[model samples]
Target: MDAFSNVDSNNRGKRIIDGYTPEPYHMPWIGLLVKDGKARCTAFLVSKNANAKASVWVLSAKHCFNDVLFDEYEDKTINSTSYGLLFGVHDLRFSTQHVIYRTIDELFIYPDEGLKTKDIILIKLDRQIKFNSYINGLCLPDSTEEHTPYEDTPW
Candidate 1:
């Protein structure tokens, strides 16, 4: 039973995530950080830069590369150039034909940043990512949806 019971599914209302994977290539902008050919963390393609052009900018949680297990590099530092991201893939255990791995040329994070607080970082791919049906950049939200009207988010 939903408030929009009267409303049909055709009328998309503030869509909610139900752990449902969208149609393949529907979210081709998403990528997984690959460590030794294994997926570790998640990353998403954003911005169109001249260097890498189509989705050159990769945004990910800074804590993903943290040295300490329990702490966010409170005692150590994060190896920015250690890991690489694998795009055009849905699963790591099984390799797909479109899986493309790109090394991390560099990573950017605040000097005094902490994991408990803001734990996000941006990475630059060693090479440009070719945009395809299963690999592309996502459009950064403009000023249209400023604030999420709902409170509970499962992202």
Candidate 2:
């Protein structure tokens, strides 16, 4: 909510109902998962320690890898042996100085014990990540508040 709050955007003469462009370093935890050369889903940077001076782990939803063993994808043309990660990506149009691309070395997936997206995949990068202003890990809070409708407020 600093300098980038409530900015308006136009999409090719179309009016956007709601849009958001993250400020630089505002959400260092966010990342993009790429299947082969195309983007697929979202990911989040995580750290084992609270301090998080240096972290090597990445987390992404397991559903994103549905086509993994089935032969890359249902198309049968694309063969996905592994997935890629793009971090610090504000815009996907072009690469920026703050942007980084990493190849995944291994994946630790925790499959559902009988639930949807009870799935989480842990990724290990080929190389270690160096923390900077534009790149950092997220330390989840001990607890989070449940969202309730603001029905009591006046419309």
Candidate 3:
């Protein structure tokens, strides 16, 4: 038997009970510049994590990635490059202070309708991340869960 088994198990239980969740592995915002169906410019957010890989999905206007080119370009199709999400920003400076995962991979995109501007996107990190400070993951709203808003209204 391992001498630390008892102590290790107790520590694991405490971690869970205290709601210790993984922090956001990626920056909150990312910017992409699409010109002639290719990404040219990029932007990133603050608060970086250094010990893991991050994945980011591009959220853009429907016309950005969709096959809706105007005029004579209507028939042309734009396919994503293999590197796709794995590419990193060129101008963004990455260091121990403002770094989140070393790289990004496995990217996916979802297009939203016109009314809602369905621009929201979610992407998973290529690998697990470790942070210098404690971090908490954001909670997404569930469709089936009951939610109550102020003024006796549920949204």
Candidate 4:
């Protein structure tokens, strides 16, 4: 058993009930998806660009783009230029030298009507990311875990 052994069981794959802000770089894969300079949703780096040293692909929630709060964009085609990802920063309110913002080059969403249980979207950055201590990709799940039950899995 470790310090988080109890937390791990209680949380059941979710963050702490009342979580405190994590230190910078503690969760390097985390990202902030934004549109026109405002926050849209939270995202995470899933893989690195094949030809680049850092990650360029991120995963986010599909509802971020479909929510009634963002209805202004539902009728208009989503312009990649208007969206971006902010990586390597913990606090957006403060200016940070470690932050890196990348414009979105493309968005891949599974066309699910009514946006049911399939709530994921993949975003490609316009340029290759440069990895630092504060930015990196999360390890991808292996094929063996494909059939594992969600409740028993660790993200």
Query: If scored against the real structure, what TM-score would every candidate get?
Result: 0.66, 0.68, 0.30, 0.70
Give the per-residue lDDT digits (tens) of candidate 1, residues 40-140.
Answer: 56788776542344656788887777653434445333353455677786543445678777777666775554688778878887777878778888666
Which candidate has the highest lDDT of all? Answer: 4
For model 2, the local distance difference test gives: 0.62
Query: How much is the lDDT of residue 7 in candidate 2?
Result: 16
Model 3 per-residue lDDT tens digits across residues 1-155: 22111111121223233343333333234433333323432323222333333323333344333443323334322332211221222222221242342223323345345425664333334453333232222233468978867221000
lDDT of each: 0.61, 0.62, 0.31, 0.65
Residues 1-155, model 2: lDDT tens digits: 11111112121232334544546567787877776456677788887766768667888877777656633334322232445677776766556677777767666766454328467777788776777788888775555756556311000
**Angstrom error at residue 91, model 4:** 0.8
Name model 1 segments beyond 4 Å from true. 1-18, 49-53, 68-82, 143-145, 149-155
Clashing pairs in 3: 48-99, 49-99, 49-100, 52-101
Worst 10 residues of 2 by lDDT: 1-10
Highest-scoring model, TM-score: 4
Kindly list the per-residue Cα lDDT of model 4 for residues 62-96, writing each as its tens digit. 88877433345443336765567778767655546
User: Candidate 4 local accuracy as lDDT?
Assistant: 0.65
TM-score of 3: 0.30
| Selected candidate, larger lDDT, 3 vs 4 | 4
Residue 19 shift from truth in candidate 4, angstroms: 1.7
